[model samples]
Target chain A: MIEALFAAVLGGLLLLGLHRKVIARVQQRPGPPVWQEVLHTLKFSFKSTWVPETASPGLFVGIVLVAIGIWTAALAVVLAGGSILIIFGVYMLHKIVEHGFGLSSGSPYGKFGAVRSVISAASEIPLFVSVAAIAVFTGSLAISDIVAYQAVNGPLLIIAPPAAFAMYLVILSKMPFSPFAIVEGKELVSGYKTEHFGVWRAGLEVANAIKTSVLLGLFLLLFLGPLSPFAFVVAIVILLVSLSFVCAVTPMLAPFDSVTIQALVTVVMLGYLVLLGVIP
Target chain B: MSSLGGAPWYILEFGDELVYFTPYTTTLLILALVFTVLALVSRPERQVEALFGTDAIYAKDTTVDQMRFRRFMAIACGCASMGAVVTGDLFNFTLFVALVGITNVGIVAAVKNRHVQNAAFQYGLVALTATVPLFAGAGIVAATTGTLSIVALASGTVPQAPFFARALLCLGVVGEGMAPFYAAKAEMFRAPGAPYVIMCSLSSLLIFLRVAEVVMVI
Candidate 1:
């Protein structure tokens, strides 16, 4: 479990670096080194950290810890091959973390970010569709059981492409530079994270990296089936590259539009699930 | 009966009826307990100037009593949520849900802002009306199954409930601020305090979860 946590954090940072480089190349500019995020994390860790005078000191500090804790729990769940329902529950609980992050600071920017977080929370419902589809196909909600099913029946992506596509969009919404990034867009001066600085901000960044790794790892596990260590590394690289390309080409959507697009996708995914049931 | 450290593990009886506690209920109890402690330690954001006005703001300021009341309501919300999750009796679950709703209002009712007060009032109205279906559903279940005990329902000793009663139970839970009704409660979140305000959302969520479990088991 500790190794899984470490891998999620480190691998997530590396993936962020890779994303930066990929986006920079797309924009016809030289980006920072592939290890730039690693340096950024190290720098923030050593820097002095403090709670803003205007903020609720306890919640401000507690939220950062909660952010890290929830992501770590998500990673551990995935690594341990626990029930998917628990993973979904943890993912839903993240809305509280985001809400706490924004409201604890008492900044309008943070509050707006928090509101955006709430609005975008509707995006989580589509994930349920994916989980249901997988459960229908694999007959189990346990990650290990799903992996075992895939070993016999082949990758779920082959049987349920629409669900896989929905999961991909869910991952995109979480990644930087996507339309759903409106919560922390430039206009909000980093949104809910505006008040966090120094080591506290670093903690959030590390947590985000782990979250990225966990989501991608989950996507791979669900769609690509279980893989050898080398294959797993390759899968992560391929997934990150694809996500970077999408992030590079797309502009951030207005908050309302982002929610609309995700809601539309969710409706479509649900329709697909219904059709899957009707056809077979 | 099975026991955990000398305490009863499976059943808790009240008068002629009983409630069952399974591992799922235990898990949710632990979760509510953890969040309750988090609510206690976390500080409330004091941003009255931002919400109302910058001029002294003495009139609308939260009094010590109001703050204490909010704290009490938050603790009550947590306890009610734990009760809703752990109780094996359908009627007891409804009672806990109602307590959770009322305390959810209390958690934010102390805020002086018109908008916050209005939103809380609106939420209170919804919660008040929601009890109709909540209790009606439980009554319907008891009339049909001859008991309100979830253990009996789950053990297949009782007949399955009709769709109308199940839908009513779900309706009552959803009325407590899920989806369509959430808009009425969303503005209540603008209340200045983070810790107590969070309980408003957390309690509703926990009740919704417990309701789902109850509906499935019953």
Candidate 2:
């Protein structure tokens, strides 16, 4: 289990590197190597780090630990085929983590980033809606049950396309440069992360790497069912490339615009849920 | 009983009102514990604001007196959210949820800033208005199903709670949390006490997540 987790961290970092590369190439810029993010984490870890004078020392440091801890728990949940509702819960808590990261730092930019994170809470609502839509079809919230159901009844991607679409948007909203990631917008100078540097930033990088792996793996598991290890890797790459294309082509929306779009998506997903006759 | 979702793994009974731990509730319970501990140990940060037309940066300090009230409210909010996560009675869940809403207001009400108090007052109004639906929804569930115990409601022994009752319960939570419209909550977070202010968001989120399960189960 530990080895698998380490591999997930490594693989997830590579995927993030590839995500940057894909975006760069699409924009006609020569991109850094696919191992850039892995090296970036290593480099940040070796730098000197300390608590800022204006910061709440306990929370400034504690929030980083919490950030990594929750995502680690999330990765464990996905690995164990636990309840999908737990994943939805983790995804929502992540918004708080972002808020924590920004607010604990005491930087105006970080607070603004934190506020944007709060505003972006609407993005994850569709994830809950998607989970409910899936449970409506499978009659269970357990990941193992959903996978088993898909095995017998084909991929839910075909069976319930709207749920798949909703989950996809939820994942997209988390991607580094996607239009919905206003918390990490450039205008805020790395947004919530503006204040976290050195070892703290490295810890966040590790968490983001694991988050990337877990969300993508979850998407495949939910929509495509189980696959061989090699097939799973291939599917993730294809999905990452698709997301990168969308990221490269579209400029990030203004914060409110981004939230508005995500909320609209939630309304539409809720409409889809109503059509499916589920009141969730 | 060891199922990943809603199986009751541990139960503490108060006659018919029980505090139960399903794997789902356990996850939320742990989150509440984690944040509660953080609130206890963590000091509020001084917010740094750059001068409008100068290079000077000013840091706003949090007074010990200020921390006392917010910390107490934050811990109270945490306890309330934790109760909402584990309670087995539908009415208790609604009650716990409402308590969280009240504590959320208190978490920021200690701040002297007009902006923060303004936000808290508006949020308090929304939370107070939301209680009618929360209690009414729980009341309707008991009236129709003739039981307010979630264990009984989930056992298929009684009729399902009407769709409106469940929807109203969820609506009440949404209002208490103000999740879909977090603008008011956002303004409260600008008040400069991370640990305490977080309780406001965390409590509402916990109740929101718990209500999702409650509405589905009951």
Candidate 3:
């Protein structure tokens, strides 16, 4: 379990770095190496760190721990083949963690970021629609059950294309530099992360790494079902590269447009779900 | 929690309430506990605001009296969320969900900012109105299925809840402050208490998660 977690963190960082590289290459620029994020986490960790003067010191510090704690628990859930509802729950909680990151520091930029996080909360609804679609097809929320269903039937990707697309959009929204990531928009100076520096920021990086791994892994688990270890790596890389291409071609949307697009996608997904006769 | 080391698990049940933890509710309860402790220990941050035209920035302190009230509301919100997650009864779940919305408003209403006050008022209205559907959904389940017990409902012993009841329950949760129409809920985040303000979002998420599970089971 420990080794799996360590690999997940390192592998996830490399994937994120690769995501950056993919975007940079598509944009006609040389990007940092795939190990850059791993190094970035280390660099931040060794830097001097302290709670900000204007902050609630307890929450300022505690939220980072909570952020990491929740994701770590998420990793455990995925590994245990637990209910996918827990993964959805963790994704939602990550928003509050971002909000906490912004508001705990009392920085105007962070506050704006936190507010954007809340406003952009509408974008998360696609995830629920996708989950519902999956639950409809598989008739279960547990990961093991989902895998069993896929094995007996076929990949949900082929069976439920619209559901897959909805999920793809949901994952796209969370990938760094994706059009919908308004919470960390450049204008807010790293947005919710503006005020978290040094070790606190490093802790957050660890959490993000875990989150990236868990979400991507979950997508594979839900759509393609179980795979051998090597196949899992190959699958997630293909998945990440596809997501990167989407991120590369798109411009970060104005917040309202981002929310509107996600909402519309959710409505369309829900319509498909209705057609499935899962929803009434 | 079922097994400290992955042993085969048995669900632990409490007395007549039949309250129990599935892996889902256990996670929710842990989250509520974490944030409740955060509210208990964390002071509200002194919000820093800048004078728009100039370089001047000042930090506004949260008042003692307001802190006390928001803290109390935050804990109440947390407890409501915890209850919502663990309750085995649909009626109790609605009651707990309703308390979560009311306490969410209380958590921010004392901020003394006009923007926050206005938003909270609007949010409170929606939250209060949300209960009508919430209770009506539970009421319908009771009327149609002849029971409000989720355990019994999920047991497949009773008649299945109607499609409208399930839809109403979901709609009520969304109205309780789930997104796509959370304009007032977003505005209420402008309230200055980080720990307290967080419970508002957390409670909504918890209730939403719980409702999804409930709707599926029943």
Question: In order, what lDDT does every prediction score?
Answer: 0.77, 0.89, 0.87
lDDT comparing candidate 1 with the true structure = 0.77
TM-score of chain B of each: 0.85, 0.96, 0.92
| Candidate 1 local lDDT, B1-218, one digit each (tens) | 11111122577777655755554455456657767777787667765344355444321234678778898899899989888877878898899988988998999888888998998898888889889998999999999989888767866777987667877897887676453235556678777777777777777766765665566456
Top candidate on DockQ is 2
Candidate 2: where are CA atoms >4 Å away? B1-4
Ranked candidates, highest lDDT first: 2, 3, 1
DockQ of 1: 0.27
Which scores greater on TM-score, model 1 or model 2?
2
Question: How would you encode candidate 2's per-residue C-alpha lDDT over B117-202 as one tens digit per residue?
Answer: 99889999999999999999999998999999988888879998999999889999998999778888889989998988988888
Better of 2 and 3 by DockQ: 2
Q: Per-residue lDDT for A192-277 in model 3, tens only?
A: 99999999999999999999999899999999987999999999999999999999999999987888888899888888888999
Candidate with maximal TM-score: 2
> By DockQ thresholds, what CAPRI class is model 1?
acceptable
Give per-residue lDDT, candidate 1, residue B22: 52
Q: Report clash pairs, candidate 3.
A: none
lDDT of 3 by residue, B77-180 (tens): 99999999888889889989889888988899888889989998988888888888989999999999999888788878888999899999988988785546
